[model samples]
Target: MAKLIALNKPFGVICQFSGDNNTLSDYVDIPNIYPAGRLDKDSEGLVILTDDGKLQNLISNPKYNKTKTYVVQVEGEISDDVASSLQKGVQLKDGNTKPARVKIIEEPSWLWVRTPPIRIRKNIPTSWIEISISEGKNRQIRRMTASVGFPTLRLIRTKIDKWHLGDITSGSYVTL
Candidate 1:
């Protein structure tokens, strides 16, 4: 039988199974399972792992259009115009992204304090926004925020399609 696991990948952990830095293998002792999709080393949150190749494609492939939700903490207070701009799909170097669902949200209480923490400026205020995008582009969220004048200070994936980060603790996995 195929096994599916959701791992809460922490900041600084490499997405690959093997490397000099902290890698999936450090936390996952399972055999043959690979990450369905990847998160950048600086980004943290839910990573789905599976031994089934077909299942992996279904989750990772942009064609499937799985809705991936991210909670982002950006450097400045988000304006209504910026929120609208993101929802309308901002153009990138690759091209215009698909329209995304975006809204300003309060900092989630469930959010864990990041180790090494994000830098803070005394005068600048930060805002939280929830963004859900169906397309999985390389560093898409980070790029999008940067293009709109507010750079993302921190980002966390809270959900991927039907699967979610849920009550899973950082650096741990929940088998589903």
Candidate 2:
């Protein structure tokens, strides 16, 4: 039988199973499972792990076009122009990103406080936005927000295709 696990990765935890830094093994004890995709140490939210290679590729490969949604807390309030630019596609050093689904959103009510909370600039207000993209480029969400003049203060992946973080607390996992 194939096993799929959805994990709510916490901030400061590395993606891999083995490393000097805190890693998946510290949170997940399953054997023979691998992450379908990766999230940066500074980022939080859903990470899918599975023992099936084909399923991993299906979720992680850009060619499969699995949409991933992120809730971003940015340094400055998101503007109409910034949201438009993200929806129209932002040019990055790697290349032009595919157009994304962008919308200004309120901070998630279920959000947990980071252990080391994000820096607060009393003069600069922060706002949240939701962005959905199909590509899994490294630091893509952070890069995209930065390009739009709103550097991301924190990022959390909320959903991937049909799966979602839902009520899962940080560092918790659900087997499917």
Each prediction's Cα lDDT score? Answer: 0.95, 0.94
Q: State the weakest 10-residue window (summed lDDT) of model 1.
A: 12-21
The segments of candidate 1 whose C-alpha lies over 4 angstroms from its true place after superposition are none
Clashes of each: 0, 0
Give the per-residue lDDT digits (tens) of candidate 1, residues 39-92. 999999999999999999999999999999999999999998999999999999
- Candidate 1 Cα RMSD after full superposition onto the native fold (Å): 0.7
- In order of appearance, the predictions have TM-scores of 0.98, 0.98
Segments of candidate 2 deviating more than 4 angstroms: none
How well does candidate 1 score on lDDT at residue 35? Answer: 96
Using lDDT as the measure, which candidate wins? 1
Candidate 2 displacement at residue 18 in angstroms: 0.7
